[model samples]
Structure formats: structure tokens, C-alpha cells
Target: MTDLQIGNHLRKLRFLKGEMTQAQLSKNVGVTRQTIVALETSRYAPSLELAMKLACVFDCGVDDLFFWINLEDAKSKYSSDGQ
Candidate 1:
């Protein structure tokens, strides 16, 4: 099975949003600055509610903020058999 990874554009989006600070975003989302750091570093995946809140803050779709990355493609080449 392929390893599915969650990726985000939090840092880029934050900068685009008036150079918003990590602390500011965390405050808006009712979380700690560390949480924002974790998000920017891709060390943590936000919960559904958190994701929604972030999207709301940016006035964008959730898909615009986060996405799925197939890690297997990055790590090695492989083929899947049709089932």
C-alpha cells in the first residue's frame, strides 16, 4: 500500500495573508503558536474542525490549504496490479 501523507500550504498562505505571524494565526484558530509551528513544519496534522477554522480564516477551501501526497512516489518507483 502507498503511504499517504498530509501536506499543507500554511506557511505560504500565512505570508500571503499580510505577513501574518504564527502567534496571530494560532490566536485566530484558538491554538498555541507551537501548533502553528508544527503545522508549518508538517509535524502535525490539524483535526477536521481545525482545518475548517483555518480555511475560514483564509477565506479559502480546505483543499486549498491542505492536500494528500503519496509518499511511495517520492520514496521509490512501484507498480500496482489492477484488482
Candidate 2:
């Protein structure tokens, strides 16, 4: 099976949103600045509630922030024949 990874566009979103700081976003999401730093660096994944909170703060959908990435070659693994 391919390794599924979660990725985000947090830093870019923050910059697009008037260069919002990690401290500011942390406060808005009721988390520590370190948590924001971890999230921006992809060192940690947010809980579902936290994800919703972040989306609410940014007025955007969760999908707009996070996405899935396959670490391995997907085409070579999962075949249409279900092999």
C-alpha cells in the first residue's frame, strides 16, 4: 500500500491573510504558538475539532488547508483490477 501523508498550506494561507503571525493564529485557534509552529512545519497534525476551529478562523474549508499526498507511486500500487 502507498504511504498516505497529510500536507497543509498553512504558511501560505497565513501570508495571504495579511501575513498573520503564528502567535495570532494560535490565539485565534486557542492553541500555543508552538502548536502553530508544529503545524506550519508539518511536525504535528491537528485534531478534527482543531481543524474545524482553524477553518472557522480563516473562513475557509478544511480541504482548503489540508490535503492528502501519496509518498509512493500510486499508479504502480493500487490497480484497477483490485490486485
Candidate 3:
């Protein structure tokens, strides 16, 4: 079985929301813009409370915003792209 890694669709959600900036989303979520950046880049995983807050801002459920991917899938996707 593959390990799980958390991922998010924050960038797409922000774009759908009138091209909302990272700063705007962070402010609405009560977090720093860096946190929003990190989440969008998959460099960070939000706490449950933060996830709920983000979902609220997008008017969606947390599961719709974030998801667990198989680590092997991530590795292959990135590695094959030379990332």
C-alpha cells in the first residue's frame, strides 16, 4: 500500500473566486499569506480548523478542497517531470 500525502485545490478555488489573491484568502481564513502559499504549493498541511475555515471561504466542504493522494503517485508525477 502507498502512503498518503495531503493536497489541496486552493489555487483553483481562488481563481474561481474572482481570481482572489493569496492575501485575500489568507485574511478571510485568519491565516498568514505564507500559510496560504504553502498550502497551495503542497509544502504544508492545514489543521482541521484551518481546513474548515478555508472551505467556508470557498463555500465548499473540506473534502472538496483537500484530498489524500498516494505518495507513490506524487513521486512519479513529480519525478517524471524532473521536479
Candidate 3 local distance difference test against the native: 0.92
Off by over 4 Å in 2: 73-83
Off by over 4 Å in 3: 76-83
Could you tell which candidate, 2 or 3, scores higher by lDDT? Answer: 3
List clash counts for every candidate, in order.
Answer: 0, 0, 0
Ranking by TM-score: 1, 3, 2
What's the alpha carbon RMSD for model 2? Answer: 5.9
Scanning candidate 2 in windows of ten residues, the lowest lDDT window is: 72-81
Can you write out model 2's per-residue Cα lDDT over 1-83, one digit (the tens) per residue?
76877789889989989999999999999999999999887789899999999888888999999988775756556664495
TM-score of candidate 1 relative to the true fold: 0.87
- Per-model lDDT: 0.91, 0.88, 0.92
Q: CA RMSD for every model?
A: 5.4, 5.9, 2.8
Please give, for residues 1-83, the per-residue lDDT of candidate 3 as tens digits.
Answer: 77888889999999999999999999998989999989998889999999999999999999999999799887899899974
In model 1, how many backbone clashes occur? 0
Worst 10 residues of 1 by lDDT: 74-83
Please name the candidate that would achieve the greatest TM-score relative to the true structure.
1
